[model samples]
Target: MLRRTAPCTQAPTTGTVLAGSLWHEAADPVTRRPGGPYGPLREPDVNGVALPEGFTSRIVARTGRRIGGVLWHPAPDGGACFPDGDGWIYVSNSEAPLLGGASAIRFGPGGAVVDAYRVLSGTNLNRAGGRTPWNSWLSCEEILRGRVFECDPYGSRAAMPRLAMGRFRHEAVSCDPDRGVVYLTEDEPDGCFYRFRPAYWGDLTSGVLEVLCATSDRGPVTWRRVPDPGGARAATRDQVGDAKHFSGGRGCHYADGLCLFATGGDDRVWAYDAERERLEVAYDAGAPPAAAEAVTPSGDLYVTRDGGDMEIDLITPDRVVTPVLRISGHPGSEITGPALSPGGDRLYFSSKRGPRGDASGTDGVTYEVTGPFRR
Candidate 1:
């Protein structure tokens, strides 16, 4: 494989793609192998996964297939959907397919790269992430020792030690288009809810990161500062950089209007309706079970958990979390990375069926699950 290294600086100006836009087209100019606008999927019945009796799945694109200049590695965890011309684009959060793999890199099947800044290196454990109104991916490192990274439409990447997001085991993130703020969650035995207010709005390094503390009045709790839990307490933080700066915030998003979407160790989905200054359990997926991902689209709210009875949980607009998809894998292979197509017509998730160590083509797959998302 031809490997390249570039500085992680400068104003990322990827020619064709916009920092605040979406990517949805085929990578190569030749035959246009569309990335996809997938809906609920069905396993192949024989050796593949089976969808619900009535729903169906067709492979729009999968990992390990060569789309353009890059042969994508099997998706281990984390992904994002961007607009790429007439079609939609998909980027995986994976290590390089080869031995010394790179992280936070992407291919162009969904869109074309007209600029010189393509391919990124050295970001790790990138689990679930949210698309920014600015059209970038806020990729988080799941390893108790990881950094909250920012990937631009132009392909330039940077790591932010902005201690505001809390320094715990980070799982996922979601954005608020109107407020221009990002909500975060932590993944640990006991974690917390957090919010990162970009003091400079779009600027990465400069921002105020905060955590949520549920109020007893059943009203909106105040933002608690994530402390420098040093020594043993700092385990989640030191692995990446500073322990005092980061906190263990996990899965979250803007589910209903300004109401914050949150879930994690508590197995609980809470909606912190900021406008109303009240906190409510939109749904309790359950506690002990880790709620890794959740998002509020037009129809319902969806979340995935990594626990004994691993299953993807779904909550209706009325606040109901039902077990939708059961994942089949151990620790590293646990299911994660749930992203939506630009139109919100489809859903995507990543599973690493491969062993804990192996990185490339380990029989892992990036799944396309479309709707009518039914049982």
Candidate 2:
């Protein structure tokens, strides 16, 4: 049964409002200020990657390889890291036709891949997903009839689709455990921001799917239900009247009581305040934002650019935007699936289309970067 709790009483953190202001001002002006934590990005000694000073990375897994009886699925996209005993588990999405699903790579204490396997399969365009605080991975399918599937990262069970979450072109999801709510983003030119109030906290089996309606960036937000949860005829966006539109909505992550989402078509990252019923632009890069991942508890944000240099930009609690890593050599590929380990010392992300362009035939590559990151 679904459970209901009191509405979130937390106010928007001061840091959140400050970061929102950076969207309008100059990009990374604080970089010139003295004693910043960020330093110049160094060309990686390894091939196909680059990172900042004091940081090092290695390719953990790649597409088209066979491990544990399953072909390592191609088009490695969004992923999340989970704790597994003394080690860690990294679950990634495969954006391949027929083979699209999720793959899990278990990492040892020393950061080596101890074992890898296909945990979820037979889905469509599993682009990006988020891990719930309740110990499950919510993988999203980026196709018209796409649905959200909840996967057990430990492979204890089969992935189950949460049909009530609504059928649409889903990109990513962010869960607010405290409120038993999950925020979803659609990957269409006129996609809408969505929230699922699950019948039971952390249980997605049943819920009411609602779309946000906002007239401005600083919004007194409201919601309207999608007339059709099934994509039999009209899409949820077409059915929901007065729903707020996002340009090519992409990644979403929840932190500090706010849900942060990105629109690649508009090059903006927005924060939705559930408690206050407001939506505001947190950052605007003047170019499409590929994904937005938050460092939990700390409320810091990491966003990847949709095109061009394919750099992973970091937004500190103080609202300083800095380029942390750049995926060079791949012209058409973008850095995606920016996730932190359970401990936050290690960062994981993927370069869709690998080191070459999208036509390179090779699907993609995933990397792990370890360093002293501020919590």
Candidate 3:
């Protein structure tokens, strides 16, 4: 039999401390019995990596049971960071559960539990979303026919699929809220970069869908929408490739001054100056993906699977990438969902559990690695 105490309190929030502190609640092994779900964190260890000195790891929420106010499914995928006045707004990309289903959740306005509500409802395969200056959510669907829905944090979320953003396997998005430009990435093996500039600033549904062609220099020459895959994804890929205007199809980011970061799945990150329309290699981590994120205030970046242990990495402004922690590549250890707290003290990440009968099993658990983090 397995039992978990009601969360004693909201997960602890701490001031910056080197080496960091692990939640006292941790230290017991969380286990589940036959016909039961996994339990809350216990006996959690850093595995092989030791806390730098004051840093520590804590299991925030685990699979199957009530965690952070909601019932976590088999696996958590993408995540986002939002500013909550003095605090921070954190969201999870609860991807498709191996068991299958879509349950939407929200946090911070109240507590962490997920209540069945209509704020942003009914969708599966939720991946990642970009933070908007207007403070809204642009959650993307990872399914073949998935849609991008605009979720407003304050009122009712826009339910229509912003078709102007172009249809494909939308994975991640970077928004230039200042200029109303939303840069998005497709998950195709050789996915393309897309740009959507609202007909009116802040309006997402109305915009120009353009692809990018990287110039010998960093400037991406524009290739407007050619065609959505009409039965031939390869041919459509070729279409975006050979078009004279073919350009701007790598994944990209839009930050202050409109600097765009896009990668080619070839393990390359590009920094493009939208205002100057010039491009430059940001960093070359190798392999495909270019799939990464930039944490604010500190301007640090965490790169995801580029053919290695689904490890968590921090990219410094000096062009150096450092490993913070690594979950084993073993089935239940593949790191997927990761989001930073406002203070950057805690990192929330998720991975799927092993199959019901698999040895190193899991249902998918979300963990909170706390302690001090530096740029």
Query: Best-fitting candidate, measured by TM-score?
Result: 2
Q: For each candidate in the order shown, give its overall lDDT on alpha carbons.
A: 0.46, 0.72, 0.48
Evaluate model 1: give its TM-score: 0.65
Candidate 1 off by > 4 Å: 1-47, 58-67, 95-120, 153-168, 214-217, 224-249, 258-263, 286-297, 305-314, 318-332, 354-361, 370-375
Count of clashing pairs, candidate 3:
32
Local accuracy of candidate 3 as per-residue lDDT tens digits, 1-375: 000000111111111111101111122222212111111223325543223445566554555677544565545555554555444544555555333222334445323433322225567566565545555556677666556777654334444567767666666676655456777766666555567777887777676766656646344555566465332364334556543221233334454444344444444555545565545554444344324543434445555543445555554443345555555534334455455666566666655442231222236656666665653
Clashes of each: 37, 3, 32
CA RMSD of each candidate after superposition:
11.3, 5.5, 11.3
For candidate 1, the per-residue lDDT at 287 reads 47
Window of ten residues with lowest summed lDDT in model 2:
1-10
Q: What is the C-alpha local distance difference test score of candidate 3?
A: 0.48
lDDT of 1 by residue, 1-375 (tens): 000000111111211111110101111121111111223434444324344444433333345554445554554565555565445555556533222122322323442332222233465555555556566666666655445666664455543444445555666676654566777656655555566777777765656666565535145567654444222466532333211121234455553344334444344445566555456654343243344343422343445655444445554433334555554443455555565554444566666543242444355555665555421
Which whole-number lDDT from 0 to 100 does residue 102 have in model 3? 28
Give the winner by lDDT: 2 or 3: 2
lDDT at position 349, candidate 3 = 60
